[model samples]
Target: MFPERLKFPRRPRVRRRLGLGFVLGLWFGFLFYRPVAGLRPLREMGRAWGDERLFVRKDDDGVSSLSEWNVTGTYKGAWGFLDTTNNSSRFPDFKKSNGNSVIELVSTPTKIKGVHYVQGVIIFHDVFDNERTVGGAQIRVEGVYIWPFRQLRMVASSGKGGEFSQEDDYILSNPYHLLGVFSSQVFQESPRDKIWRRKNSPVLYDVEKHCNIEFAAQISRVSSNQNDGERDNYHLEGLMESPSVEEDGDCFSPLLLNATSLNIEVYYNKAVNYTLMVTFVSFLQVLLLIRQMEHSNTQSGAAKVSIIMIGQQAIMDAYLCLLHLTAGILVESLFNAFATASFFKFVVFSIFEMRYLLAIWKASRPMNNGEGWETMRRELSVLYSRFYGILLGGILLMYEFHNYIRPILLLLYSFWIPQIITNVVRDSRKPLHPHYILGITVTRLAVPLYVFGCPSNFMRIEPDKNWCICLGIFIGLQASILLLQHYLGSRWFIPRQILPEKYSYYRRLDQNSNHATDCVICMTAIDLTQRPSDCMVTPCDHFFHSGCLQRWMDIKMECPTCRRPLPPA
Candidate 1:
């Protein structure tokens, strides 16, 4: 019903692109956000409350402590089995009730004598395991935070709660939580206290809860950090000091209670930064491909690239793509961060690169058979099967021997092996571009370095300096060899005695031989006795002027006379 001139075109592609860009920009903006703006109201409320409560305080330390103790907001944590099988086995619902809880510290810590405590309030809600809460229970939390100790000694009692909120109650599995959950930190002597242990310098805490049963917990501060995260990062460790012996209920078994650092912002930032790095590097690789494509690369240098190495890289990029895609679907922010990077990665990295790599490989391979077309297709299929079979086998190996991931990675990065071997075997002349070698080596190393070297990477894999150094040296050595081959000939390292006889194009015609023939390329030669430099001889017994043959090979890498393959000068 709309007028033809006024009707707008529905360009779904453009719309989608714009929408994606907007979402990515929004997430990128969030990456730089230090503190959440939503908490400003709560912080201000705490300040106002502090102003009124300050008049009642006598000690400066008490006043200062109260000001920092604005623990009135929401707290997220869960109960899980703490791997200490001997103790954790006691919890009946340990596996099924491995769920999370959101506790709102709805009021300030009311002081009694010399300690602060939060007791007898609607503190926690919507606690779930594999299923919902069995029956309502009142959770009472009372803690004495001693500044001298930098410790939290909290005891909790339970009865019944009125309501619960199911918002963001994720069906969670421990991702990074299990990394060092069982590990202990080293003791360091601080100037403030002579006895320095993890017990003294603690952060946000831990707790234990049951749907209908009464449980008690001894809470200790695991860790606390400032400026690095939005909240105080903690390793909340809970120990049940008491239990309701009278109640017949499925109570917390092992009593391995924990409070943890929920650093969503830090996670978002890390993912975004890594995504950006990959996007930029992938783009540079595409550019290198473009430059290479511009030149007439007819005689394939597929031999110069390692197929196994390419397969390893292809699998790496494929994993990254899968990772980004899954994370994007789960997190709104990650969708924006991953989209552009994933698109560019396809151009130079993952499955897209495999097709290009294969095309070059197939073109370079000899078609010696009479029934060439069928033979080539079968060979290609066989190559594909072999490549994927190795990849599958490698995956299984990784699964079976998970502890040796570092060694597997080191082996995978040795992608340049094929090129080095090919150059030595075939004695190909400058098969790989110097820029391509350098650019790829550096870019490929970035992902591994970020995963294992960077402390704040979302993966949170511990930095291994020795591994990083070894990887750098390893890749650097490969690039150096390739560059040396480009300048000093492919078999430069081989001894003179071991080298094969190089074919001679500059063969001289002696007095006994009248080897005079016309230059097939220019159709004018017959100069047999001028000089060896004046004429060139093909392996097929054809002759041509040196300059004429040189120029002809540049256009077509085959014999002008016999139509046979010509070796690069």
Candidate 2:
């Protein structure tokens, strides 16, 4: 018999909830609250992109225009201007200019098959007011294209002295080429002036089309006090490079092609949708897992440990949902790109994956040395889980040093799910319920599909259609399995049955028996005279209430007092 002092401790109540609440509160507070000025909540800071406007002015003409110039660049294959700084150094000669303002322009022309083809321009501007007292300065120019296309033709001077025509013939011919025009900026000493702009006309598509593009930066600066007739003189100098013509068939560099052709909107939309889907699915799974855990009996050590693991996973999933929601909001808000959020999300996911693997390792211990196929299956799980778990964790750690590790990590993560699910199914002694099977299968398939389909890294090609088709097949298979299981009226989830012969073997105590004899399962006295059928005596001579014994047996086929194994149903 088990010693009375060796009684199992009752599970703590509200502990998991308290931990979950604490974690969630910390996360919300970090993302939504700030103690420092200028450090607004993520949600509010994100609005700067939409509300901030750029004012550009041409110094000579004093013509000013308003433009929304968002940061644009490629991040993990997605295009947008988020978390990117636009700052360039001043030219050597222009550094001595009045306000330490310098603008350098370079133009390159490409010739293909003895024909002049494309022209590209790169402009670098740097301005600084050393005198702190100088209120502000402005730079403005006319006839500058805001969103210049790949193909551009400079208009000839309209017989005016040192002045080119404000209108270009190519602008009218290619109406779509004009995305916007450059406005003026009234710079303050507090925020120094810096601008880096690159524009290239599209070269011909044929690789045989040897094309070159040339560009130049034209800028003028006027101080805020210039209108007061103060003795302030601005100097303008132009430096032009001799055009180099190439006969080679290199139409354009691959990097240049990608930068010009990329459609930011498409990738941005895909990211938002993908994050939303992950959040929804993760939330649903958390709810379902919690329900399953609550219904589970935790009398056995393994069951108790599994319950704790599930609770941890559910909490992690809830956090993941929050992260995804926050990331989606920031990306959509145009305040920040997905880079920062994606990194944090990846870290959290890596930690969660490690914990999950640990749980699986613990759960598989009992079957590791068992006889027959169970032993082989358990060994397989242990080997793969250990190998991949170590590899994945190492890769995540190494990713900080090298970005190329991301693709490999994603590939491994995709396959890890299926391997885990296979082990789970193999480890189960009884057939899994259809709902359980469906959930596992869908999650395994969906994660890989989402990982591979989403823009997680830089790639020259889009997602393959074949992979998408395979993903759809997996989804269909899950639905079919659910339908088939339901049609067959599977008894997978039914409670264990107690044979009449087994119950009849338990003898009921009489009224003369000691009133202090209590059932081990419920700690209640076995009052046989009050209700004879409700009391039972175990084969070990220990007594218990019938209902208590039945409930105990439902969790494990063992005697509550002696802990002896009972006959299997």
Candidate 3:
């Protein structure tokens, strides 16, 4: 049928190979080459724009290189647009030069004393490629480090392809001496270089729009291979600026002057405030825990507390600690920023909340009802499955719906709801002290508010006014409901019309019949002739002196005679 498509797979296999090749070719082309607008081959890429080669000056400053200073490490910075995009008169033509690539300089030393070879990859986008449609280019660069002037003189050569993915062909692309020493301005007038788009096969933007551009930057040493001074735990401040470099008729690379450098430092300072805020919140938790201990017996009194709410708080602390700890260990630069904050969180969670959580778990356990072991095991398995399942499912949900993080936070903070229901369900009275409720609510809001409300947050997250206001209102409302439950009775909010009738222990008993019964606790005759408050009645119709039963319920909630469960006062 259908011309015997593969012909039973003959021994020659030529037809099979041809068919497989056709399928694979289509798949590869679909996966790798995504042709979009403004993409063309080299010739159509306008005139091959930029600098012509000139002689490099190697006559050195004649000053000896510092023994400890080695320009052999990585430096990260960004190509800037800055005030230019405001339609500034000075660089009006720069409106098109909007695409930027994050520059990472990997340097190594050579046999020559003050000379360090540098290779840079222009990843994500470059200055020239205007379309920004397809933006990846690699530049193999070598620049002489001028220690006297603190500059990378640009007598540079260009090589293509990616990082060391291929064999060490860097040797072939040499005269390694022909690194970044520009006869133009690179080592000359202002230390700026006009990068050329000609000698390279265009990697960004199918090739057509070859807009020549200039790149001006300043290099500073903030850290080193040899670091000392303040003993700081390793934590990196992840600061990001706009990595966009644009292209027009002429590319205008931003000349980073003193103002730009000052701005960068200012941004870094803001991150310090973030870490400080975290430390402050951790200390607040300590104070809150101490206050709670004085008010209630957490192990036994926590029976009425919502275990989910407490465990949710612990989970939040654990995640925060793990995140900061992992970041500190992986990146040396991050150690100072994340390490101390993580330690504080670890101490607060491990020593403080973990113990609280275990106590809550034990106190909140379901009472045994003489069920078989298999039934209990199945129930526990289901319970554990729901917990870890929510943990994993939440990660995927946040990834898929990250825009709805505010709503997620709202849901997270609704942990108080379980306690409110538990109070009504069990008809318990004053399970949590008022001080604990108020303290926990306020402390929990610290991290979320700093992240979403503060404009100067280190994470560079944009502040959301509407979301912040809504979150505050939502949390306040929850607190208000809990406070109402504390003062106005758990069932006070329920309409009287719908409330089920409850048994009353204070109704006047049969006067003539009960006047003769003796109160066991006080070893006195019952004062039944007095008001209803003077006599207490148990559901079992047993009588006790009112003052005696009140004091006994303080230690244990049980009827003295039958030892049966007693309702809360």
Rank the models by lDDT, top first.
1, 3, 2
| lDDT to native, each model | 0.55, 0.36, 0.53
Model 2 misplaced stretches (Cα beyond 4 Å)? 1-273, 295-427, 430-433, 443-461, 471-554, 557-562, 565-569
lDDT (10s digit) by residue, model 3, range 83-174: 44552232332344334333334456655434455554333243443422122343334445433323343322334333452223332121
Question: After best superposition, candidate 3 residue 79: deviation in angstroms?
Answer: 9.8
Give the C-alpha miss distance for residue 162 in model 1, angstroms. 27
On TM-score, the candidate that comes out on top is: 1
TM-score of 3: 0.56
Model 3: residues with Cα > 4 Å off, grouped in runs = 1-259, 262-280, 290-300, 333-340, 365-404, 513-526, 544-556
Q: Which stretches of candidate 1 lie over 4 Å from their true place?
A: 1-262, 293-296, 300-309, 329-332, 350-352, 366-377, 511-518, 523-534, 547-557, 565-569
- Ranked by TM-score from best down, the candidates are 1, 3, 2
TM-score for candidate 2, please give it.
0.34
lDDT for position 312 in model 3? 72
